[model samples]
Target: MRTLIRGMLEFLRMTVLLLFFMGIIGQLENSVVKMIIGREGYDGFRFGGNFMFLIGDLLLFMVFYRNYLQFRGWYTEEAERLPKRVTRMMLGFGFACILLPITIALIL
Candidate 1:
């Protein structure tokens, strides 16, 4: 448990930056969509909606990278990679919170 906490702490910096950049990208995407559609609301993408989708893309990338690193046996010390596990859990939680709503919005 301590290791997990440590791993997460170590990974937090990168994650925070990624979230910030993703937010900007999300806002950008939303702006473009709003401009094209010339409106806002459910019919067009908003910052929060686009942010969730960007986060989904990031989560997919992280998952794939973790698997690739694990498979490649590139780590000198496996403990250093423990954060990847925590990030996976984070990804799951994020998807549940963000992606799920997006999905429901798309469907209904």
Candidate 2:
């Protein structure tokens, strides 16, 4: 049961990290594409953007997997209670994950 809980928490951590990185990569891709094509209003779906997301996410997955492997022993240990500060921070990021897309949509 402890391992199960720990795994779930670790999965949540990975997911949050994935979303954060994807957001950053996506913004960078948009900025670069806009600059290269010299179009300020090119905000529609494009094949290149899809390709970028696929490749960038795959690369990030590999990196995260490698990091997980490096710390596999720690992750497998018995789960313990999280400190209040850590819990708060995780909740904050979780809320950010929920709000970020809406904020971006409003901005763009």
Residue clash pairs of candidate 2: none
Q: Which candidate is the best by TM-score?
A: 2
The residue ranges of model 1 lying beyond 4 angstroms of the native Cα positions read: 1-9, 41-56, 59-108
Clashes of each: 0, 0
Candidate 1 residue-wise lDDT at 59? 66
What TM-score goes with each of the models? Answer: 0.38, 0.51
In the range 1-108, model 2's lDDT, one tens digit per residue, is 877877777788767767777777667756765665545533543434454445545554544444443255336554344555655555555445433433444455
Model 1 TM-score (2 dp):
0.38
**Which stretch of 10 consecutive residues in model 2 shows the poorest summed lDDT?**
97-106
Name the top lDDT candidate: 1
Could you give candidate 1's per-residue lDDT for residues 1-108 as a string of tens digits? Answer: 766765675467446655775767567655654555455533543446655665665765566445544344323246234376687696786566455534555554
